[model samples]
Target: MSRTRFKVILYLDETEFSRAAAIYSAILMMNMPNMHLTIVRLKESNQSLLEIDEKCQNIWPTTSDVPQNALDVFLARSKDVQQQVLYSNPNIPDAVTALLAYVNKWAIDLIVMGAGEFSKIKEVIFGSLAYSLQNRSPIPVLLVKELSQDFLEGCNLTPTLTIVPKNQHGN
Candidate 1:
């Protein structure tokens, strides 16, 4: 018998929310046996070496803050997952474009990303990637918020996850 697999991409950035998103993705991957996860981090060309190093340190181990037992399981499941870094300009449009290009190239089935805190003014000046992907992506996108320990302990996921479909607005 053949098994169906899902190709999922986890988008990363330098934010606490992004780290939370990574952890959430790890947990989801643990539960979803048919999922093939890929983590993609976008680094702008203008970022200093130190900044890149910091981000690399945090994301490579997606399970850094997870409990030891859960970390072990997450690590084992992540063996088949891939980590990739894409370099581009430090602009939302450019970053989104790079990710979209990769999504197209990889034929990804879903995109998992964090909804970082961006002010309305900043979002107006520079469009939000989450918003852009919501309107642009052809496949499903999962946006994860920074989850609290209490929430995870209760195993409540609905409050933390937002599923965005192509050209649709998600709350």
Candidate 2:
């Protein structure tokens, strides 16, 4: 059977590891041949870089931060990698709406975003974007809280886990 392309959208904003997540996602995407990574940055700023082309190999994806900053990172990558990347910055009024629109438009399989830190009062007043996305997103939403390398190095997930039946009779 042919493997379907797995599209993962890496949502970026003003949060910890937001920039680094792009590089990390790219590296992670490299390992998964069938996976396509699209980096999305929605924050508005004075500077912006808009480069979205399917045939162009040297084009960059859109970013809300300093245009060159995002470009410099991707520019340093090989042409093959650059060509595989597809970027888009939605112009919708609400962030959740914008992200959801892109998700449907791109036929995204998964949505990955950094787990931002927000004060309790702020969350109570404004609400958490991550939480809202998790609740509203049609597909699965993965929240990144730490560097992949750190988490991978610290935890060994290969061990065989024993399964205990939940309906077992009392001993």
How much does each candidate deviate from the true structure in C-alpha RMSD? 10.2, 11.6
Off by over 4 Å in 1: 46-59, 62-71, 156-171
Instruction: List the global CA lDDT of all models.
Output: 0.69, 0.58
| Per-residue accuracy of model 2 over 1-171 as CA lDDT, tens digit each | 355878887776765656555545654554555666666655432232333345654445656431333344444433323332223334322557667776787798988777766788987787776778888999998876656667546533222224556555332
The TM-score obtained by model 1 is 0.71
How much is 98 displaced in model 1, in angstroms?
0.8
Alpha-carbon deviation at 147 in model 1, angstroms? 1.4
Root-mean-square deviation of candidate 2: 11.6
**What's the true lDDT of residue 171 in model 1?**
20
lDDT top scorer: 1
Please name the candidate that would achieve the greatest TM-score relative to the true structure.
1
* Candidate 1 local lDDT, 35-80, one digit each (tens): 8877777777765321222344235443443334434544576555
Which residue pairs show collisions in model 2?
A: none
Note the residue pairs that clash in candidate 1: none
Using all chains and alpha carbons, the TM-scores for the candidates as numbered come to 0.71, 0.57
